[model samples]
Target: MTTATTGDTTPTPRSRLLPQGVGVIADVAAVAALLAGGGRPIVWAGSLGAVLAGSYLLVRRLGQPVDRTAVVGLVVAVVGAGIFGYALRPSPPAGPAQQTTATPHSTDPTAGSPTPGATTNSTAPGATAGSPTPGASAADTPAETWLADVAAVDGGEGWRHGAATVAGTEHPRSVIGSTCSSTHDGHESFNLARRYSRFRSTIGMPDDAPNDAHTRFRVLVDRKVLFQQDLRLGQTATVDVGVRNGLRLTLEVDSIGTTSCGDTAVWGGAVLRR
Candidate 1:
């Protein structure tokens, strides 16, 4: 007589791996939903709960046994998901009740009136006319009159008005005068007619000028020189002269060297103030 052979009853590796793979996919989906919906607690919680419940039902329908360890793990996962979802909930918006309430002042008849010794206007004490007042708006302040904006009544051929760069500084409103060997001197005169009381400008040679280039700059009131300076390629000077009661305002530039190579002078930020 021959012995009867029996089929193997042990579970295969693939059978175990299939269930584990399904569980892992479900877990990844839950975590993704939680992270993606961090600001929406309801979306995160609902998605995670639905995925876990579906996974459990699917496993049960596949004839998988529900053990004590699996049941404990499922409970732990749900509790942890709830805690994280609650923690990641968005904060409530601020309402009118949460706003800061200012304290009410006493109901006195003279409460809003100006006190004695208090200054009403924005200008400070002893502030002169045409001067910039403290805390004054742009409308209240006097507008600047740039000399470059005005047409010169008498100007040399080399005189130019517009934007220019001097000593590596930019001047949006400027007047430039050039002096060469053919013309040793350049001048530009504006008819102020005694309207302006102060004149301000920065005098310097153009940055593109030769290193040895030297020139003399002069500011004159009614043909009288009020300010003068000799400047080199990189030298600069500030001209703040009083042109009070002056009829004519003139700017002159003269080449100091015999060659006068690159003797380009610039009057940067030239303005007349009243």
Candidate 2:
């Protein structure tokens, strides 16, 4: 009686999981095949590895035990991807081209010019005696230099007009012994030497009249006025009217009507060094 009847029982849950395992294997193979055709080899490897690990997880979800080796492989793949992402980044661009150096010009053998970097400021070094001061004007021009250098005083410029020669005229009317007449109250008379000169001279007021009649000369060097005498008629005296530098040398001479002061009577001059 106890020997009983033959009975059938349901299989364990794990027995049913074999089909999911097969499905996971198919999914992993499909993912791997797709990744294998990717353009980049590194991307293909990473994607294939990830898909395999995902298949293993799916197998474990379907009641199969997870393999520790598969978890380690997935971790290693992730680390490798991070390293690749860091190392394979694009670098900065190549810069512009470098500049080319210029070649020196060939020298002429017959020329007397010195070679480059050979000519110095002065002939000798450590020669402080002949060194020039910082603010020195052309204050020491020799006689030969002075005679060689000449320039036009003023032409179509400033208050004075008409051409006034620097060299004294033949038998200049105003000299050491000459008798000159001061026609107006403010008339400038000048003394002449063997080498007498005038920088500027005028016989009449400017065309702009009294406003522009005064001449302004910026005295650079300390100057001496040889003599300024008021000679009306048959009157004469010797005097020294010296002027210092930086001072404005103004010669404001009055006029005797429109056509009175001849060129010879009114004279103005400056002595400058180059």
Per-residue lDDT of 172 in model 1: 77
The regions of model 1 sitting more than 4 angstroms off are: 1-143, 181-185
* Residues 172-207, model 1: lDDT tens digits: 778888886365347888877656679999989888
Our tally of clashes for model 2 stands at 2
Model 2 residue runs over 4 Å out of place are 1-48, 51-70, 73-77, 83-88, 91-214, 219-274
lDDT (10s digit) by residue, model 2, range 1-274: 5887766776555543344444544444454454435434554454455555545544455543555544544444454444335334564465655545676654677867777644233222112222233343333222111110222221111222223322232212211110113432222222121121223222222232233222211211123443333323222222223332322222333323333333223232223111
lDDT of each: 0.69, 0.32
What TM-score would you give candidate 2 relative to the actual structure?
A: 0.23
Model 2, residue 87: what's the lDDT? Answer: 36
Could you tell me which residue pairs clash in candidate 1? none
Query: Residue 226, candidate 2: how far off, in angstroms?
Result: 21
